[model samples]
Target: MRTTTAPGDALGVLETAALLRELTAGLISAADFDEALAQLVRTCRAAVPGVTWCSVTILQAGEPASVAASDEPIRALDDVQYGDDGPAITAIRERDPVFVPDLAGSGRWPRWTARALALGVHGVVSAPVDIDDQVIGSINLYARRPGAFRDRQQLTAMLLAEHAGLLLAAVRGRVRADRAQPQPVAPGDEEVVGHALGVIMTQRGCPAPEAREVLRGASRALSIPLAELARRLVDSVARHHPG
Candidate 1:
């Protein structure tokens, strides 16, 4: 819950605590709660000095995608979707944190390591973001220098990941409550599900039927109920289009 710095460093425990409080307050009060996730990664970059880049990787239907990144270069995380050997993948799959103090010297994930090295990333840490014992994603931190991340930085990242998880859970809860409310002819559930399907259709450039099918596929792959998956998708859309 605290981060330390050298005597003259600009950041310290007080600053870190203030950042955490700000993030928590924003997530709790924001009308569009999902947008708070993007803020989470940005906060990570600011709170941790060794973090050169930050990204949030969301796992849906057994597929992982980077939903928010601090910089354009960090978008290379999309490539990680192709393989299962990267730090983020490991973190989510194992429900644990993975830290590569020196990406270039690490023996694991040769392909991902090479790609990260090419991007001037020499160290990385990934922490699982979970809710109710289920790991839904990870927060990945990248550094430009070897051994850039130490135990303190890892602890800070983990704390941020915990906050991110709490925010996501809250969003999901809201969506579920909205869907559960009583309604006339067209139930709230169906309405929200339809909206979610339309969102998928637009984002994936597909038709309504195809988007519904995509949702079903993801639901089955991730072992999440269709309605729950729909809620998550709707939440995601709301985050991007807060207006």
Candidate 2:
């Protein structure tokens, strides 16, 4: 199926360049890289005309997980990850952009197509976020209408994904260097944080980075320290989903 954008519906090259500049600036000034990733998804949703939602799927430590999503009801991403056949996974695996113009007629990953349709997502475009030769993750955009993403939209998404990949690479490098230095943590706090991350991973079916971001968000919302919030979450999970 062919898709076209109205004259005003698509961003001009100059506008696109300005938006990318803003994103790059934001990434440079962001206090936390994970939070920046969350912001990146939100920016993607705003920059793309037909995008109803956006998410970032990172493959780190041999685990693939949706680390940031613009919407809360992103359970479909989990299905894609589990099935290993959706556009997001394919984009990262192949290190290329994957566009599903019409999910209903795609004839690929039937389960994922059904789930996405049920979730009101009919179109998708996923672009691999790469750093050098490494495929770090993917930037996935979803649309509510079939064939919503046209070539222009795909190109914009690809550009954004490339910018995100560069930022991620810098952030990962900084984190690795930090890890080499001595850091202090309160007694038992690390364990509590780990347990809380695990609980979030189990409950949300997201990756470790995503779970950590969730914890950080909760901490900010509740005006509590991260360790304390983690402790609370661990206790709550134990009470509810006791193993």
The best candidate by TM-score is 2
lDDT for each candidate structure: 0.75, 0.77
Query: Which digits, one per residue and each the tens of the lDDT, describe model 2 over residues 45-64?
Result: 88778899888887765466
**Shift in Å, residue 220, candidate 1:** 21
Model 1 backbone overlap count = 0
**Candidate 2 global lDDT:** 0.77
Q: What TM-score, to 2 decimals, does candidate 1 have?
A: 0.65
Q: Candidate 1 lDDT, tens digit per residue, 1-243?
A: 244555454446787788788778766665543576677777788778788998888766675534678877776653564564788888888888888889877899888887788889899889988854432888899999898888767777787888878877887677556544432333657887888888888889998888877877776566576777788988987898798
In model 1, the runs with Cα more than 4 Å from the true position are 1-13, 31-34, 132-135, 179-243
Worst 10 residues of 2 by lDDT: 176-185
| Candidate 2 segments whose C-alpha is farther than 4 A from its true place | 1-11, 132-135, 179-243
